[model samples]
Structures are given as structure tokens and as C-alpha cells.
Target: MSGGILEGDRNMGLIRAQLRRQRVLAGMNQDEFGKRTNYSASTVSAVETGTRAMDTPFAARADEVLETGGLFVSLLELARRDGQPRWFRPWLDAERAADQLRCYQPTLVPGLLQTEAYARAVIRCDDKLTDAQVEQRLAARMDRQSILNKDEPPQFVVVLDEIVIRRVDEAFHQALADQVHRLIELAERPNISIHIVPADIAIHVSLTGPFILAKTADGGWVGNLENQLGGIVVDKDDALATLLSRWETVRNEALSRRQSTELMKEVVKSWT
Candidate 1:
């Protein structure tokens, strides 16, 4: 096999091992495990054999049915962070394994869809990272985009605060415009849904920060919170529920897809 395909197989192997070990410990067979995860026996076998990738929804179901202590869920985070930026591993891992990725960003576009130029500008502005570190971080961010192309890629749902469109600085205006245009193009894909949360909307749960809600292959749900220094992964059921409720409200408040695309086009035009 070619190098890229080989690497994918190896990565899937790690996840398969993680699941197989836990399932055996729990004393369950493929069919029993499949039933719990809402997958067919063949699908489970394929996942175990590295022929397929498990997304968050299935991961969460597997976790619940196997009664594992977030093993399947944690592996996804680990995989994302592997051989890349250390600080971002937790969130990245969750992103790769997510069956459904729901994001609420008040200040900018989510990382997955960010264009290279826009990502570079954002990284450069970070006073904390050295120049080389910024470049490295940018590369890592770009690499994360591959998750959107994996077999059975996770469903991505993102909400952008309208202010993000208006907040570009003079220094990065051109790059930001390119980024917005890139976003509009990417949003046209079937797997991605982009929503704009109007600036005028009433306050909601995610106002204080950005967060991601991801499900594991075993039916486990995890909520991720990030800041300038570090991030926390929330696994407690109550916390996940609260985050989900907040996300639902935000989703409700955001503009529809058609409206968002039209708004995006208008924003991009202003830069030209």
C-alpha cells in the first residue's frame, strides 16, 4: 500500500486495539457489541480490521455498551494529537473521532475550515508562540483538515458569531477575506453546515467561550473547552448535557444555510 493509506491503516489499528481490548474485558462478542453501538456485525468487524474509521456517534454508543471508562472516546483525542502540536492534542483527538462535531465560535471560524492564510495570520498574532512555533502550529491546523475527508467523515455543524465577519484587522484583512471566501466554498459541501449567529441574538450558553461537542464510536459524548493556555475535556454526563442544550439554542438562533451563504458572499465582496 502507499504510505498515506498505510498510515491510515495503522491509525485505525490503534483504535481497533483500544476497542477490542475493552470489549473482551467486558466479555462481549462482535454481535453483542454491534447491537449496542447500532452497527452491524460486519461494520464492527471492519472497524476492528482497520477497513473503516469510527466516527463520534458510533464511538459514544460503543463506550456505553462496553461500559468502558471512556476508552474509545479518549483514543480519538490521542490519535488527533499524535505526532503534532502537543497542546492541541486533546481537542484534535476528539475532532478526528467525532461522529458529529458541533461547534460554537464567537470570535472566529472553527479551525477545521480555516484557510492556510487565515490560520497563519491567527497564529502570528499569538504573542505566546515563537515564529517557528507559529508556523509549526499552522501546519498542524492544516493537517487537521484531513479529518473532513476520511471515510465516513464526521458530520460538522458550526455556528459563527456574525461579529467574526466584521472583526478582521487591517493587517490581515486580505487574508481574512480569502478565508471567508474559502469558508463559503467549503460550506457548499454536503457534509458541512455553516450557520451565522447574528450579533443581535440574546445571550446564550456559549457566550463566554468556544466549545466542541463530539461523540465517540461507542456512544460516549465529550465536550471540549479551550483557551489561550490550555483546554479541558468534559466527560461528565451532566456537563455534556448542558453543553448540548446550549448548542441546541445557538443552532436555533443562527441563520439558515441559504441566508448564511448570502451573508458570507456579501462579506467577501466588501473585501474586493
Candidate 2:
């Protein structure tokens, strides 16, 4: 295994042991600790066994209730962030474990579905990242696709606006054309679904940007919204419901999977 994988595994074990020890020191059983922490006993067990990692808020709550002087949470924060922004960890967690992923992209292809060349170009265009930083970001973005290749992979659904395909720069236009054709091929996979909204469509949900809705195994859903400033994850019941409803409407306006693929082919022809 690579050094990164080895280091990540080691950190996971450390966090698990810390959490388990604290729970036991508090004289708490799995169920009791889970009840106190607002997580399931199974989830707590997974974290403790190093099969899953804990999130920031959960780590803090665990520290407070377990009375471990906040040590575990502090250690978890240090290890999780490593060098990137804190938000990256939760996004990764959701991407890795989701049973289904639905995305609506008004501007570009969703990161998980992007080709490496396209992803690197997109990252390079972002002023926030240096050349080296863009390379790292590209690697992380590509790694996010593993969930789709797993044994029981997530059902991947993506809806793209025609504008996203139409706005490519001429320098990379041929590459983008190839990229879109590749996406059409991906849509043909049994586990994947793709939709494209017509440019002339009169109705759309999110006019300003893109978002993702991921469904977890426990009937829980989460929304990811990104912007120039930052991004937010919405797990609140009402917010998730609202996003889901809007997505349904948008999906209604998009072409069927077959028609979407045909449309993409035509769009690619125009690129040449």
C-alpha cells in the first residue's frame, strides 16, 4: 500500500482506540455511549473498530461526554485536516459511503464524473490553488470516483445543463468533446443515469450553481452546495426535503437518459 494509505490507517486506529477507551473509562456500554452521543451503537462500533472515521461535531461531543479532557477530538482534528480545509473531510466521508448520489450541475461536470485532464484544467483555473496545490486537488477529485466502482456501488445520477457543455474554451474544446462522449458511455453503465436539460428549457431549479444530494444506507440524505466563498452541507430535515423536491422538478424538465445521451453526441459533433 502507498504511504498515504498506511498513514491514514494508522490514524484511524489511533482515533478508534482513543474513543473506545474513553467510553469504557466513563463506564459506558456501546448502546449507552451511542445514546449519549446521538449516534447509533453500530456507528459507534464502526468508529471504534477503525472501519469508519468520526466527524468534527461528533468528536467534540464525544470528548465532552466521555470526559477525556478533549484529547481525542483534538487529535482527530489534527489528523483529519492534515493540510487541507476541514470541510474536505466530511465531503469525502459522504462521497465514500453514500448508497446513491444525485447531482445537478449548472456550470460543469460533477467532480466525480470528470476526466482527470478536465479536472486538472478546472483546478488550475481556480485562483485559490497554486500549481502544486492543483495537482493535489486533482488527485483527490479523481479518488472520489471509487465509490462508483465498488462491488455494491452507489447509483450515480447526474443532470447537466446544456450550457455547461456549450461553454468550453476552444483550446480544450476537443478534449471536452471527448470528455462528454465518455460521460455518455458512462451513462450506459447499469448503475449510472445521466440527464441533460435543453438550452431552451423555460424552467430550472438552481439558476446560480450546482449541488449534490447523497442518500446514506440508514434512510438519511445530505445536500452539498458550493460557491466561490465556501460550501455548506445540509442535513437538516426541512432543507433536505426542499432540495429533493426542487431536484425532482428539474429532473422532470431534463431529457430521458437515452435522449440525453443522443443530445450529448450531437453536442460533441459541434465541438469539432
Candidate 3:
């Protein structure tokens, strides 16, 4: 383990090494350390090996279990910005303050609707991403879902191209099934409405890409446009108008809420 700290003490490698040292000095193996921290042995091993990022709760638990005097917590605080890309961070605020959120996904499940296992599989598809990077993004996605679980959640409206459900992760089939099942469950919530655009459509505006718009608590709106590299926050008047127009076009093609729920149920059968 490197003793010298990175400039901001933000390097994840430091977190990994420090955790390993604390475990060893405490005379605990991964399983024992995990038990004390309420995590699995595999999770401990992953963090130590730089395969999984250390989240705040785990860091706080480690401080208690390892008696590090909150050192681990401090380190994670400095490195917290790495949890999500800078470009996408602004959107998270918009999501949390939203009165209503509308989204269109042509390729896969929306982040708010993903299960942990399913989120992992989708995130790992990026060959260039390290396991640690994958876990960081996955954690951010999971955290983003909390907005929906709030006491007064935003009304979340999602429109998916039929292929989103039809395309399943073969290697993680069961997780994919669980994800579809989750969508069905979420559809039952009063504040959530999910619609699916059938596959037979020849050509539609949704084929262009995916975008999300949130009507904030202040009665203003913000939109997001994502692509291969990163995403842009859409707030300019003309841009938002264009984006809203596009969303309406794609949403118009979707099956009604009742029909969509039945469609999702039918899709789950294929997965089984």
C-alpha cells in the first residue's frame, strides 16, 4: 500500500489499501471484517482489491468496526465527487426537486426503474470501465432511485420503445426477469406511469435517442439529453421546447398504462 496520499486524498486506491491494512491490523479476515461492517465477505474483498467503490454507509460502518476514528469517512468525503460524472451531477439535483419527471428510453431500462443486479449487468457492458468504475456508477444509479421513494415523490412518467423490454441480458437472465417484475411493481405506484411503444413501428422520433425532462418544484422545467460520451442539461427555452415536442411525439406511440402493464407481464414470461 502506498503511504503517500494523493493531493486531495481522493484516490480510491488509498481507500482500498487503508481498508485492507485496518482489517489486517485488527486480525480479521474479509469475512470477519464484513460481519462487523454488515457487508458480505465478497464486498470487503472487492473494495480492498479496487473492484468495488466504498460508499458512505460502508465507510461509516468501517469507522465503527475498524476504529479508524472517522479517517475512512473523511477520505470518502473528498472523493465523493467521483461517484457520478460531473456532467451528470446537475441532473441529479433536478431529479430530486422534481414535481414530475418524464423520460423516453429506446435502448434499455431507465435508471430509476433498475434493480441492483440488473443495474450492475447494464453498467458492466462498457468494456473500457474498470470494475470500480462500474460499481461507482451503479451506486449513483441506485442512489438516484431514492427520489421515487421519498415521502412526496415526483410523478415519474416513462415511455420505452418495445425493444427495451424485449432485449434481455442473457448472462443475467434472472436478474433481467427480476427487473421486469420490478417495473410491474413500480407501475402499481400512484405517482408512476410507464408506457411501452410496440416493436412493429416502422420509423419514429424515439429512434433518434433518449431524453428526460423534469418539471421542478418551483414550476420550472429542465431537460437532459444523453449520448455516448456524456449528457447536456437542456434549459434553454427553444431547446426545451424542441425536446418536449420530441418527447410528446414518442409518448404518443406508447400503449396505454393498463395495456402497458399487461405488456410488461407478457414480456416477463419470455424471460422465464
Quick one: ranking by lDDT, best first?
Answer: 3, 2, 1
Tens-digit lDDT string for candidate 2 (197-265): 999995666766788998999978988888875678888899899889989988888999999998988
Query: Which number leads on lDDT?
Result: 3
Q: Give the TM-score of each candidate.
A: 0.67, 0.69, 0.80
Q: Model 3, which residues run further than 4 Å from truth?
A: 1-35, 40-49, 63-80, 169-172
Candidate 1 lDDT score at position 245: 92
Residue 166 in candidate 3, Cα distance off native in Å: 0.5
Angstrom error at residue 40, model 1: 50
Alpha-carbon shift of residue 118 in model 2 (angstroms)? 0.6
lDDT of 1: 0.77
Worst 10 residues of 3 by lDDT: 1-10
Off by over 4 Å in 2: 1-83
How much does each candidate deviate from the true structure in C-alpha RMSD? Answer: 13.4, 13.1, 4.7
C-alpha-based local distance difference test score of model 3: 0.82
lDDT values, one for every candidate: 0.77, 0.77, 0.82
